[model samples]
Target chain A: MTPVSESLRAAAGTQRVPVFRARGVSKVYDMGEVKVHALKAVDLDLFQGELLVLLGASGSGKSTLLNILGGLDVPTSGTVVYRDHDLSAADERELTRYRREHVGFVFQFYNLIPSLTARENVELVTDIARAPMPATQALDLVGLADRMDHFPAQLSGGEQQRVAIARAVAKRPDVLLCDEPTGALDLETGKRVLAVLEQVNREVGTTIAIITHNAAIGALGDRVIRMSSGVIVEHVRNERRASLDEIQW
Target chain B: MRALNRKLLRDAWKHRGQMLSIAAVVSVGIMTVLTMRGAYESLSSSQAQYYRDTRFPDVWVRLERAPESLRGRIAAIPGVSAVNTRVTLVATLDVPSVDVPALGYFVSVTDDRGATLSDLHLSAGRFVSPRRRDEVVVSDKFAIANAFVPGDTLRAVINGRQRDLQIVGTAISPEYTYAVPPGAIYPDDQRFGIVWMHRDALGPAYDMAGAFNEVVLTLSPRADTARVVAQLDRLLEPYGGLGAYTRMDQPSHFILAGELNQVRSMGTMIPAVFLTVAAFLLNIVLGRMIATQRTEVAVLKAFGYSDLEVGRHYLQFALVAVLLGALIGIAMGSWLGQSMVGLYGEFFTFPTLRYEFSWILAVLAVGVSALAAAAGALGAVRRAVALPPAEAMRPEPPTSFRPGVFERLGLGRLLPVAGRLILRNVERTPCAASPRPSASAFRSRSWSSGCSCSTACNT
Candidate 1:
C-alpha cells in the first residue's frame, strides 16, 4: 500500500469509517492529437465526517479527483467504491441516483442560477432531495437568513458563495465536494465562506473535501494532500486544526 | 412553483424581447390560416343555404325553341323532379343616368313566383304584376349601381321595338349570385343587368307565344345527375337543343369555386412560409441561449436533475411563446375573418354572411405552431441534455482563430481592430451570419413578388 493509503487506513481504524475507497484511479482526456493524463494510478480513501483539503496547482488534477468522487465523472481506469456501491461500474442513470442521494457540490464561480433568489436556489436542492432541511433553514445556517429573497445579481460575491453553500447543504448529502469554492472571492470574503463550510462540516457531521491551490487554507483541514503533475507528492495529518479567524491568505 | 420552474419563468422574462418577436411571427402565420379558412367556410355555407332556399335548378338546357308541352315530357324522365320552361331573350337598354348603352337579360317569370325552379329574393317593391305587361323587376346590383328605385322607368329595344318598362321591384337570385355578363370574366354592374318580366309578355316579345326557349329542372336527391343530363339532351335534340349541363359547369358557380380554391391554397402555402422562417429564428435564438447557459445547465445536472428534466425545462420556454402567439392569432383572425365576410357580401350577393369561428381550426393552429417551435428547439435541448456536467462546469476553451479568406487574401490587415473582430466572429459563426439574413432577404423578395402578382391579377 502507498504511504497515503496506509495513513488513511490508520486514521480510519480508531474513530471513523472510510466513506470512499479508490484504487488505481487514473483519467486521460483525448483532445485530438494530444492526450492529457490528468491522474496517474492514484489511490485514496476519505473518512466519514472528516474535513480533507486537496492542495494543488492549476493543472494538478485536484478537481478531477473531486469530480470522480462526487460521481460527476468516471476515471479512465479505476475502481471507486462509495460505501458499498461500485461507482466506476455505474451507468449514467445509476450515477445520477447516486449523486442525488449522497453527493452535494459547490463550484468555484458560485453557479447559483442568477434568475432565482437565494432561498429559491437552496430549494432547488431540497425539492429533489429525499430528506432535506427547509430551504430557509439552510440559508440561515449559511448566515444568509435576511438576504434569502435577493437574487444572485443583487448579492455580493461572498453572499452568492454563501447561497451556493446553502444550496449544497440543503439536501443533507453524505459528502460535500467543493471545487475551489472560495477561488473567486477576496481574502476576507474567502475566509468567511470557508468559515461557513467549516461550520457545516462540524455541525452536520458530513464528510467534506475542498480543493484549492492556497497553501495557508490547508491548516484548517483534518488532513491535507498535495499533488503535483497528476501525482500525490505529500500526505499530512494536521495535529491541530486552525479556526477560520487564525488562517490567513 | 418549484425553483426550477421559477427560474424558467424568470429566464423567459429576461429574454422577453426575443420571445415576443418570435411570438409575433407565429401569430402572423396562425392568423393567415384562420382568416382564409374561416372566410371559406362562411362563403360555402351561405351559398349552400341560399341555393337551398331558392330551389336552384340542378340542370339547365337552352334550345332554339321547345314547345311548352315538352316540360311534362322532360319532367317524366327518370330522376327528374320538377321542370320549368321559360322564354329568355337579350335586349339592349338605354339607361337614363349612363351614357354607354347597357345590355339586359330578359327572363320570363310566372305570376306565382313559387311555381318556378329558380326564384328571386325581392329586396325592394313587389314582383312583376301579371296584369301589367309594362312592369319589370330589375336586378338589385344593377338598380343600386344606376340609382334606379322601384318607381323609375327604363327604355329598352325588345325585338327591334322601343318600349318603356316600369321598374316595379329590385331582386337578387341564387342563379345570378356572381352576376357577370355572358363572355365577361368580371361583373360590371353598370353595363349589364337582369330584367324579369311576366311569361305572357316576354313570350310574344321574343316571337314565341306558346313555346319556350329554355328549360330548368330539379332532380331527386339520389339521382344520377350525369344520366339525367344525357336524357334531357336526347329529348331536346329534335328541338335544336344546346347540350345540357349540370350546375358544376354553371358559369357563376364555377367562378366562385375557383375563387374559393385560390383562398384555400393561399391559406396553407403562405402560413407554411411564415412558419418555416419562425422555426429558423427559433433555432438560432435557442441555440445561443443554451450556449450562454452552459454552466447553469451543468449546475442543475450536478444537483441530480436528469437529462429529461433539463430538456423539458427548455422545451417549456418554447411552448410558452407558442401559447401566447396562438391566443393573439385566434383573436385577430376571428375579427379579420368577420370583416372579410362582410366585404364578400358586397360583391357576392349572399342574403346573410356570418363568420363562423371553428374551434377545431384554432386548436389545429396552436398544435401546428407548437410542433414548429419544438422542431426548432430540438437541437438546443439535445445539446443541453448531452453535455457532461464535469466538462460543462469548466469555462469553454477559447475558439481557435486562424486567418480567414479575407486575411489569407491580404485584405483583412487593412481593416481596423473592430472590423477584424467582426469579420472573425462572422467567420466563426457562419450559419448565424449567413442563413438568417439570406432567408429574410428571400422572404421579402418573394413577398413583394407575390404582392405584385396579385395586383396584376386584380387589374
Candidate 2:
C-alpha cells in the first residue's frame, strides 16, 4: 500500500495559500504556419468569494487564461499553482481530479443539456461533486425555483443562463469559471444572469471569474483585468464592487 | 457512469421512430428466410406421402425395343409385383376447342393401382373402362393445365393418329406431382404433370397383337431394394432387351436432388446479406452517439469514471435497442414466414407446411442485433476511456474551417454582397450543433447507419 504521508503533506500545503494562483503563464498553439500565442505571460489570482471580471477584445486570450486557471488547459511554459498542487505540470488523471474537486465551468452558450429540465441539469453536476448543494436550492438561488421542471428549450434565453450558473455553483466549487456567461443574452436578461452570479459569490462564498468582450460588464467585479493582443494591458481594482442590480447594463 | 446511462436511454427514446423502422426491416427479412425454408420442406414430405400410399413404381425404365418374352421371367423375380409391356408415344390432339400436343402412354396392366398411388378419393371418377375404347383418367394438376374437367371429350393421338376419348374422371398420383427426394432442401418438384391411359387403348392403332414394351415393379413386403433389383436384372437378361433398376436409380430422385441443391444455396445466401447490412448500420449509430456528447464525456472523465464505466453506459443503449428490435423482429419474421410458406403451398403440393421454431435462427437474430448495436456503441466507450479529463473539459475541437482562398481570389466579393458573405463563412466551417455539420455528419452517419441497420435488418 502507498503511504498517505505525501498526500497529507500536500493537503496541508494547499490550505496555506489562496485558492488559485498563476505566474507568468503563457500558452502558444501551433496552427501549422502560424504559431498563435493564445496567452502571454499572464499573472493572476482568485481569492475566496471574489467575482473577477476578465475583459478583452476578441482573440485577446481572456478565455485561454480562464481555461488555464480552471484546470482545463496547461500553460506552455509557466506554472499554474492551484493552492500547492501545480495545475500546469499535472498529468491527465491529476488534472481530471483537480477539475472534479475544485472547479465548475460555464460556457457562453449556457450549455444546459437540451433534454434535461432546469433542476435535472443542475442535479447532473451536483451528483458528481465532492460536496454539493441540493439542485433545488441552487435553482432557487438563481430565481428559477418556479421553472425547475422546464426544459432548456421551454425556458427563455436568460432563464437558461441562470440554470447554467446554478449547475456551476451547485457544486460548491472552490472556483467557478464563467467564459462569457451572459454573452448570448440581451441587456435585461444579461442583468438577471449577472445578479445570479453575484448571489452565488455573496452567499456560497465561491470565487468566480467571468470572461467577456464587453468592457461595461467589468463594473460589477472586485478586480477588472483587461487584455489586448493576447497580453494583459491593464488591471484595475474597485474599492467596493457595485451591486449587480445597481449597475447599468 | 449511471448518469451517463440515464442520458443514453433518453437518446434512444428520443429516436424511437428510427429504431422502430429498423426493427420492422429486420423482422421482414427474417420471416422471408424462414418461410422459404419451411415451404421447401413441406413440399418434399407431401410428395413422399403421395408416392408411398399409392405404391407408385419406384423406377420406370423406357426404351425403344419391346422385350418379346421378358414379362414372365421378370415377374417371377423377388420384389417384382407385376410386369407389363406397353407402347408409349407422343401425339397431337385435334380438340373441339384447340388443337394441341398431348402425351399418351399405353399400358397392359394385370390390375389397376392408379388410385392407390395417387393418395386421393375417388370423386365421380371411374377407374380405366374395361372396354378401353378411348377412356382416360387425368390428374388434377394435368387437368388444370390443359383446361379439362369431368365429362370433357378429349382426343389422344397415338402413333400420329387421333383417337377420341371420354374423360372418365380425375385421379391423384403421388408420383405425378412434386416427386420429392430424400433429404430435400427446397419444396415442390418441377416434374409435376402426367396423364395415364389403359393398355387396351393402343392395341388396334399399332397392330402389335400382344407384345409388350416395358415392365414396372413393386417390391414384395419387406424386401431389400438392392437385392430385388439384382434378382430382376438377372432374370430379365435372358429376354435380351430389358433394363432393371431399384428406387435409388429413379430419374425423379435425380431431378429432385438438383432442386434441393438450389433451395440449400438460396437458404444460405439470403440471410447473410441482411446480417452484413445490420453490422454496418450498427457501427455508424455508435459513432454518432459518441461524437455528440463532447462535453458530457469530459465531465464524466472529470468525475473519475473509468473508460470501461463510460463505455458500459453507451453500450447499454445498444443492448436495449438491439434486444427490443430483435424480439419484435423475430415475432414478425415468424408470422410473415408462415404466410410466405402458405403462398408456396398453393404452387407446390406440401404434406403440412408447418412453422417450426428454430432456436438456432432465434439465437442468430438476437446475436446479430446485439453484436451490431454493441459495435456501434463501442467507439463512444473507447473515446470516453482514452479521453484525458483536461481535453474533455476543454471546448470541443474547432470545426473544420476552409479558408476563403477563392474569396481572396476577388471573384467571391464581386459575385454578390450578401451571398458572398454567407458563402464565405459556410465554405470555411462546419460545426457539430449546426444543422449542416462538418463534425456531426461523420459521427451521425455511422450511428444512423448502425441504428437503421439494427432496426431495419429485415428490410
* Tens digit per residue, CA lDDT, model 2, B1-459: 333555666777886775555555454445445545543454455556656765667545554454446667666766666454555444454444434444433343323545222333333467667676677676555566566777887766667676777777765544434433234433322222244566565545655446555556676777677777666556555544356665556655555545556655665466556645544454455555556676777656544454566677777766766667667767766776567656654544433445565667667656765675566556555655676555655655544444387777777757675554455444533232246433433444332333322222322
Could you tell me which 10 consecutive residues in candidate 1 chain B have the lowest summed lDDT?
Answer: B450-459
Docking band of candidate 2 = incorrect
lDDT of 2: 0.64
The parts of candidate 2 lying over 4 Å away from their true place are: A1-15, A21-24, A43-51, A79-102, A126-134, A186-188, A213-226, A232-242, B1-177, B180-328, B346-352, B369-459
- lDDT for predicted candidate 1 compared with the true structure: 0.87
Query: TM-score per candidate, in order?
Result: 0.88, 0.59
lDDT string for model 1 (B316-371, tens) is 88888888788888999899988888888877887778899989988998899899
